[model samples]
Target: MFFVYKILIINILYYWHNDCFTCIGNINLYHMRTIKLLFTTLTLAVLATACYTEVIIEDEYIDEPVLNVHALLKSHELWYVDINATSGNREVPFLQRAFTVSFVGETVFANNNIVGIGKTGNGFGLDVGYFNTANGRLQINHDVDGYWSLEVFMVDNNTIELYDSNSRTSYYLEGYQRNNFDYDMVFYDNIEYLLQEYDVWEKVTTSKEGLLNDFDSENYLQFYIEGNRSMFNSSVDPSGMHLDDVLWDYSGEYSVFGVYNDETLKTLTLDYDFMGNDYFELYVINDSTIELYHSSSGTVYKFKGKGFISYLKSGISQLDKKRTKTEYGTMKVVRKRKI
Candidate 1:
């Protein structure tokens, strides 16, 4: 009986020890799982904050004003004749008149001659100056009485600045257009004086735009003269007067040319009768050649420049025998004088 009781007691004690060990293992595992979950949550929060991105930007703006521009004209000589009042259906002197004139505005005639924009009560008056601005380009003003005037500015060797009677603005201009002048903007009057004064620009080659004329700063001299065909309305083919020959003087105030015509087989012919169409056309071509077109006999003609006598010889040699005059000796000299 005593042995049986001792065996039962030992068995009970062994079972209790096994249960205590099992409880300790369960508590350790739970603590380890809780620590792992907390670590994962902290890692996810950090990653979410780091994944976000940022962006930035800016803006732009500009401001400017409107302007009005015009090209003006001035002339010292004018000629007028009466064609309808001639006697015997032949041209007779009705009136030989001459006067000083200055004109402006647009020139749309086949001749490109235009009215002056600066026409005053007595003559042409042009007011050229500049206005100040808070910023940007300076304002150019042409305050003529008859018309609103604007002057276009250009850049050249000289840095253009704006100047009027009282003040020179911070801006400067190199060139502008006046009735498209013979060379358009290629030759601007305002910078002519400056270009002529600068040794660096002096003797520079000319282009379609203009050359640096060392003589007159206000003139962009073309190489050609202006004239009209004298035979366009004559008893001859009328169209036979289509010959053009006149060397122009861009530096001069006016260009005067005597009317002369010839055929290779004939002698030199001079035009005595006067008509309105008799005139000279001066203009620049390809910026290099100064071409002259004469109007006479109701026809228009073109001529090579006076500076190139060799060009004339080449041109004359290429003409047909009928238009070549051998007996007239040397062709009469044509001079382009300043007005």
Candidate 2:
């Protein structure tokens, strides 16, 4: 259009100049200059309009469909709270401890325990509170934690950000369904809680080839969290005895060390107050069983998890709660010893 206008203006000036010279015989220099100036101004105006119209067309934007925050909250069966990805100086205690949270109607559910994590509430855990969504915000009325209001920001189709204004913190959550979620990762990541899930681990099998040791007499084991310490109890009581009826022979602190590069393997050290520390390589046979290889004795003992203890009704133990607040990567790592 600019090119067309320039061509048209040139033709008009050519014809006008010819006509003025022919009709006036000798046109004044001032009149000729004035006519040229008027034509130049008109051409510039047309070019400016063309440029302005192009910019308007380029700047035009297509409207995106606004996300329905309420619907999104209920879309996924579970929202795994990515604690490590959280931002801000202050932490929200409930969110910090929760492995996963879910929204169903007006109720909010959270999987705070790693034990039976994939199976509890069909992977949604327990109903901790009630929640309402409005104006892209989530207001939660927790049964134990009280009330909280957070601005909901959708990060993606499967991710969301819950930003707390009062704390100036943002928590990132990833959405997943029960069937597709990686429950094994959760178990390995929080294996400490898994050990505490059972009332007792009864010795079911023992390899005969290993050398005799003090652990050979032990038939039952229990791991528990008290205050800020990870503690354990061992008993020589019969395997079929009830948890409360069994006599615990030794009680002491314990620590689980992660393998350097292996996620499936771990080392456990039971600090026996009288006999000294006993070290074993630990392996999970299934959700309800674990195998411990005593490095010193060369014995492989398999323990079956008995009497499941869910943390849902009574709330999580202090040690488990403290572990949740800390970074998982900071766990102690030990190099696997070659047999």
Candidate 3:
């Protein structure tokens, strides 16, 4: 019995020493040693009892904090609508059209205009609607699109999916702060849409270095989305004329080509119907101005954008606006005098 008790006491001391070592840094080293010494002395006195008592160790479980949907929605200042990542055939009109959306208190803001994307509302754009969250559902009451209830699914730390059951559509959004967001990418990727936002492009300056051509006679230009085609209207209505008062002398289709996949540098081709096509290198001077360098005549023309349109509050949804691709072939070059 003495030898058995000696073996049991040794086992107990080993277990106590291991447990005490766990607290080496947490507890003072001297205090841990003192605790082990005291525990060992006590265990020796109650060796028989300690041998009979079975020790069952259990792991303590910690519950993860439940994520609040409202807090997550407002965590980031801006949520860029990843329209290309949309998973469903159907789409939420407002979300499909918006470049970015923000949730601030009860107001819902959207950056619908690519021209004024980074500069407008300091990157939040305009308050186009209101939103409320409850029972893990986000309810949006848009000024033009009406009401919509969506279920939010977290894709990751910075990505989310707003799933609309009625439409069976999922709109993916990536969160970002205003300062860190890539505004230039958005501006160039959707540059075609920016052209449609202006009511007219009025000629402000014409460089005299290049040879004067038929394009010099054109003073006012208008680009509009018609059905599924990108259309342009050119006028010789002179400068300083009201946008609505300008008389269009020519109307045809236009195409924008990327120069060596560079977004900043683009070539615009004007299909002048039977008058042949005119090519010009396009340059964005500012938010409201553009420079066009004529390739044929080496003339440079600067046009200022007029009448900015924000599609968010304009009551125009994405479905209402359409764009289509057109293929052009070699046509007979015919130069006609401006009538």
Candidate 4:
């Protein structure tokens, strides 16, 4: 059947092309135009179905960045500077290193252009950082916590111009997220009946940390307070270093109480005492960690304790601005727990 149809179509084309119905000179102008139109239509139909194309579209999503500045000044180490740029250019390797990191004291961030130093002695621009120094040669030793402001000047090799100073950045060397909890605990309340349901918290490991991210303990320090009785334990030494202590105590004497700031922000105020009464602003990090922020003396204590199913609900992972992260000393609470 298919071969019969093919033969019929071929005969029809042959008859039309050979002018079996219309001769070349005798054919009407309209008739010739009509045949040409049909031929064009057939050619178009075959061409349309003969080719295929696959169009590919590429797309990407970029999140808006949160710009911040960080500078950690250690006692006998180089000061590491990080200027965080969310959307703009981050680190340019072609720029030269910082020529000077002057001691602008505590008010340098606000002082604006207090000190100035450009590139030195025809040196090529590459990488720039701050070392713990005072007069360009003498090493400066200082115990700086919380946020300290500084000024930086970089000569861009691309444009041969000074880097933009308008990128107002803050130096928050403090590692732990500040005030990481939403719920408060009361040690001397009628909730003492609930206290019996909870176990006493103790230190988990015997190691000190230079940074909150450096906290690597098989057991994290734990603390609990019900009524006027509070107990705490840690394995941190006086030098703020982690160690294996067979004499570490899990429970100590202390009572704590706390309150929620408001329903809007839900800030927790936990007040407790061991040898002396002290309070902390709580910030929650996750199910296993929280930070204790002391605003007065600029101190931060990061504690990781699991099993607080009731209190560990909301997890705010971002670092707080008020918390001191560059704690050169050991965990303050554990160091105080040395009694």
Highest-TM-score candidate: 3
> Model 2, range 1-339, lDDT digits (tens) per residue?
878887887898788777776667676799779877987798889878877643434667899987688998988888998877889988777798788999987989888777667777877888889988866679999887789999988899999999999999999999998889998877777788778878899999999868999898899999987877889999998778977899999999998877766777878889998889998888877889888898777789999988876544654542245334433333355534344
The Cα error of candidate 2 at residue 82, in Å, is: 2.7
- Candidates' C-alpha lDDT: 0.26, 0.81, 0.79, 0.30
Q: RMSD of candidate 1 to the true fold?
A: 23.6
Q: Which ten residues in a row have the lowest lDDT in candidate 4?
A: 108-117
Worst 10 residues of 1 by lDDT: 91-100
**TM value for model 3:** 0.72
Off by over 4 Å in 3: 1-67, 314-339
Each model's backbone clash number: 52, 0, 1, 27
Question: Candidate 1 residues 83-121, lDDT tens each?
Answer: 122123211010100011122332111110111212322
For candidate 3, write residues 58-139 as lDDT tens digits.
9999997766789999989999987667877777888877889999879999887887887888789998889989777999
Measured against the true structure, the TM-scores of the candidates, in listed sequence, are 0.21, 0.69, 0.72, 0.22
Q: How many residue pairs in model 2 have overlapping backbones?
A: 0
Q: Rank the candidates by TM-score, best first.
A: 3, 2, 4, 1
- Which regions of candidate 2 are displaced past 4 Å? 1-67, 86-93, 167-169, 315-323, 326-339
What shift in Å separates residue 45 of candidate 1 from its native position after superposition? 1.2
Q: Tens-digit lDDT track for model 4 on 1-339?
A: 444544765687788768764566687899879877876776666666655577988788788653212232211111212221112233221111121122223221110000111121111112222233232222322222222223322222111112323343233121111132111221112122222222222233322432333222313344444344445443333333333332343334433233433221112232223334344444444324445554444445665443332211113211111111121111223222111
- In angstroms, the error of model 4 at 109 is 56
